[model samples]
Target: MTTVHQLSSPWRHDFPALNTKVHDKPLVYLDTAATAQTPLSVIRRMNDFYQHEYANVHRGIHQLSMTATENMEQVRQQVAGYINAPDAQNIVFTKGTTEAINLVAQTFVKNQLKPGDEIIVTEMEHHANLVPWQMMAQAGQLTIKVWPVTPSGELEVSDLKALITDRTKFLAVTHVSNVLGTINPVRDYIQLARQHQIAVLVDGAQAVLHQQTDVQDLDCDFYVFSAHKLYGPTGTGVLYVKPGRYEQMPPWEGGGAMIKKVILPTGTTYNHPPLCFEAGTPNIAGILGLGAAIDYIRNIGIDVIRSHEDNILRYCLEQLQHIGDVEIYGTPKTRAGTIAFNLIPHHAYDVGTFFDHYGVAIRTGHHCAMPLIEKLGQNSVCRASFGMYTDQQDIDCFIAAIHHIKALLD
Candidate 1:
């Protein structure tokens, strides 16, 4: 493994929050999986939009509105290019990944699934992916099936195979487990669903930040992720629907921006799928910031960032293994840059509080995957996730804080 100092992350300085301190101590941010720190480039781009070129897009004929509309549309193209989609028309902007998944549930799933049809989901899904289907199933009298998780926090392929029957109408799963740091075999799973003629939707919130994603290569029916996790602004995300599915689905929401003609008494005619989904004034500045964030990632090279994160995860795991009374979770052959562990003598929340005193930030609790946590026979765990700008010192500090907390507890 290469030393951390030898790793070149010239873009580290682009994030201003890293240099700031909390209580006069340097802040060590280890919560990138939840939300990443935005780069200065994205921030500056959004500021430029508000300061000089602010206007309602696609509504007015004025010069400002035209310019805003052009920028917004160009960002949509950039987003499509980033994910290797066939065209920009396949991308639909939304509030975030949660909303995108809900859109699919309401528009595509509701339209196709019958009363007895089943939707298969894994035990490792966040609530955003799980609850939407569960609610829809309840309302429509559809059945919800789950794929079991192995002891190592991976989905059992055999179990998944057994669950997929002719009754299965759709399969939704996460590309990466947020709490377990497990990298699921999404491409293989999609292929299996294809064999069964089941549509597949992938939750790419965690995977997109750690690696490069190509929707064409994955061959999924739909892919969704939030920009906030990718060093971009909040209130912005994307849903990528295959061209065939895009044409088949109905509109999820109804409002001014989505309609072509609204008759006063009798009927309303809606626009095409993407615009029909976006009901009103969209988050134009947020999308601009996302575009800037994509530019930053491309400039720094995602491949290089992924390599660096892999090395850091390995180093963090090795260091934690050396410490006494620390139990690590999710030992997958392929994993992301998240580490979930527990101290023997202390609750995970207590451990988190101790780390806070040392200015070390980490997440604790069920991590929104209550079913998986119960399956692991643990109430909660402490998590430390990595990002492109994370360094060896941050990992060392986290490990030291854990040891300190353990000593006091013991």
Candidate 2:
């Protein structure tokens, strides 16, 4: 087991809002999985870019434009390094994870999928990962196959062989479930997909915040994640396509930046994948802030963050387990910080609202995994997600609040 204090996060001080009090009490933030609190370093980096280096990238010959372009490209390189992508050219910035997934759906899947083709996804996927393929399957006259999750909150790979046939065109799944906190065995899944010659798209929105990812090692054809969940700003995320895949996939959108030349009399020529996909004026400041966030994580080390989170998760699980009338969800062997649970005789939203009264922030409702919630025999759940800065005190406060709420409700 890793020592928590030895792995103290150095970037904690960079998030100024953590020091602020809510309702005359120190705020207990437990919704990091939805969106992490941004560090001051990242905020300052973005502010500096807007204040001085602001300009439209990849367009003008002026000095400011060149500087902005250089900065934007530098961040791309940083993101490449952050995820251990083989080349920086594989990193394409977008609005967030949803857009990144849609990019793949529009560009690659749309072109490749056909009637009788099938796409494989898990039962625990978020709507972002689930809906795109559903729409694609509907339009292309394809079949959508879902892999089963065990009652113990683990993905059942026994059915995988049956699911992947010659008709399998693509496999899309989450690296870590946002609601269940179950870390899926993505490498094994990727290997299985490789055997069937099926391309895989792994949604890293939840995993990227906790796990140390190497896209090359995973060997997935494509990976997507949002920066906000990783302590960066909102409106910034990445889609990393393998070099081979990137070369084959076309641009999803048409705009000023995506074109190399336009012949009105004939046709239009498009730029290569990364540039071709980024259609309009990109989120320059958000991209810079994302780079700073990656820098912040590197300075602190991912291993350290993972260890700290695991410790806190274990403690929270133990504490919640001890509470009477409380039932926890997703008891996976190797879970992350996200925990979903409910109290008997109380609604999840009510519990969430009660916790809010004590300045404890958590997520409630279906958590954008309505299908999974139905599978779990519920409509909604209370979710508490931890970050690197989250410690034992936050968990204690949360547990105490739950106890108090339960008492009042009873």
Candidate 3:
């Protein structure tokens, strides 16, 4: 019951996709947790790069290469600064969060764990965070431990005491639950993991736009996030390790930019941290887009965006709660951007499709976390997530659409 006013997102105009119309209705994009619409600034930046500054970085001595190299490296520094990392050198570019986590799982965790070692993860984790460990466990013969979720769909970090045994080698957790919008108390779990000398990886794909991230403050061993989630281009991601942690991991992939010297007869000496981890020519345009995205977030201010999103979250929840037949999932103690629910008799896909025909976009089904949806006693749930460009009008349109769909279905 916070004050409700005609609050519109000031930056909505910056995203041209929001202006799209379907069947004469304006697009009400509410699937941001899945993927947000790219801002014009980011689009323009990528377009400009391809038009003018396109070149392979780290391997060329020419002017275009140098410029591209400088800009790409500057993005690394920008990402480090954005997350408050101790140094930009610790950041490695990957395809996306999925690759970043898999990089760690493949390079760092795989080498360190023995047959009896364990890796701890929460029930609320996205499949990107969960499946890699499952695969690793099968490959390395390691035990995968689950940190159970409360009824409200939050990790019971207090339960960490029992899970982190002497055999625990690593722990991976998501900063925010994509399904529940629950913000886990990551600091508490990280601290506990540190006590047991277990390395931790935090997946921040759903977190970057919701609030400011300080990896230094969180003291996590490693952090991974996707650029597209933060209004950047796709095919670009960040994997940040602590100052000295990168040395512990050998290169995950091998290709052009990852090595310093390649002797056909002898062998190859790899590049240092960031470059060593980034194999091949890399996604030059996407990296530049990520830089522009960081610039966009800086100019908008994450704190300002967060306050606006929090207000919208409260407003949307209050409105949805009014529907007696609607059953919302994951009532977290504290939530940020996403919400999932089911309107009793209607299938989630039916609700999503009906809304889509009317120009509203929402995510339906397990959301890549089938175990969690099943744990909550459902096969599927509809999720509507928010972003910087989402506003009251979008929510109102969604609500109105939902009521119409409910009536039609009933």
Candidate 4:
């Protein structure tokens, strides 16, 4: 195991938000699971695009429009390469992970699965993954099967056989738990799901930012993640559809860009794969920023980033455990940098409120995973999530802040 300082990111200087002072205290942001702070590389790319190359993509015939469309489409290839997808044409841009999940549920899953068919999701899903399926199931009268989570916060893999049947139409599971930080055995799940002919969509929002994901290697049917969490701009995300599934799927929404031809009397034809789903004009500057962020992460190497996060997580786990009142949750076999815990005699919100006094930002409450948090028999918990910019000093300061908060409250 390496020391936290030894794993310190050389790229922290790329993020300007880390330099901000709140109430004269330097910011120690630890809520990256929600959204990551943007690197200047991403910011500059967006700024440059807006200043010089701004245009509505795939619609205009002029020079500015063509250049903007090329830049945006290049990011599609970049995303495909980032995830090692089978084809760049399979990558669909959405507002974020939520919209991506909705795309699958409405267009892909809805068209295929019928009433009384079953779909499996974990107890650990963020609402983005869970709610859309719940809505779809409610509408289609489909049965939603839950993959039970072990008390230790891992998915109950042994229960998979029992949950999946021939009637099981789809399985949408999170690659990593936002609250428990569990790096779930998703590959094994995918392998198992394949035998039963279940289409799997992996919610990669929390996992993609921390580690590299090769969709082709995993062989998942669909993979969705938000680019913002990868230190890119918000309002932009990716949906990577497996090669064969594109032919099976149809246009999700109707708009100008997704159309091939429109005849008044007879019919209308739709554009092919990627553009079929991207109905309207997209966030061009944000897409450029997303590309820049991917470049930033690639320059540093994901393996290096993972190693650094592992160091930080180990250090954080140790320091937080040393505090007596701390109740750390989820003893996972493998995990991410996001850690959840509760301070006895103090609610999570109160702890988070006090932590901010020390300029340490953390998330509190259910974190949009109400089902999982409620399953744990707690309404709220304090969550400290990490990113590439996080370091040893941040954890040290967080630990000190917790002690001070406990002492002050007591």
Q: Backbone clashes per model, in order? A: 0, 1, 0, 0
Model 1, position 178, has a per-residue lDDT of 95
List the candidate 2 regions with Cα displacement exceeding 4 Å: 1-11
- In candidate 4, residue 256 scores what lDDT? 83
* TM-score of every candidate relative to the true structure: 0.98, 0.97, 0.98, 0.98
- Output the TM-score of candidate 1: 0.98
Candidate 4 per-residue lDDT, tens place, 50-137, comes to: 8999888888899999999999999999999999987789899999999999999999888899999998988999999999999999
TM-score-wise, the better of 1 and 2 is 1
lDDT of each: 0.90, 0.90, 0.90, 0.90
TM-score of 2: 0.97
Over 28-91, each residue of candidate 1 has an lDDT whose tens digit, in order, gives 8998999999999999999999999999987999999999999999988999999999999899
lDDT string, candidate 2, 1-410, tens digits: 33556435555677898897878888999999899999889999999998998899999999999999998999999999988999999999999999999999988998888899999988899999999999999998999999887888788777888788899989998999999999998999899889889999999999988989999999999999999999999999899999888766788788889999999976999998689999999999999999999998898888988988888888788788789999888779889889989898689999989898999999999999988898889998989999999886788799999889988999
Candidate 3 lDDT score relative to the true structure: 0.90
Off by over 4 Å in 1: none
Give model 3's TM-score versus the native structure: 0.98
> What is residue 389's positional error in candidate 1, in angstroms?
0.7
Give the total clashing residue pairs for model 1.
Answer: 0
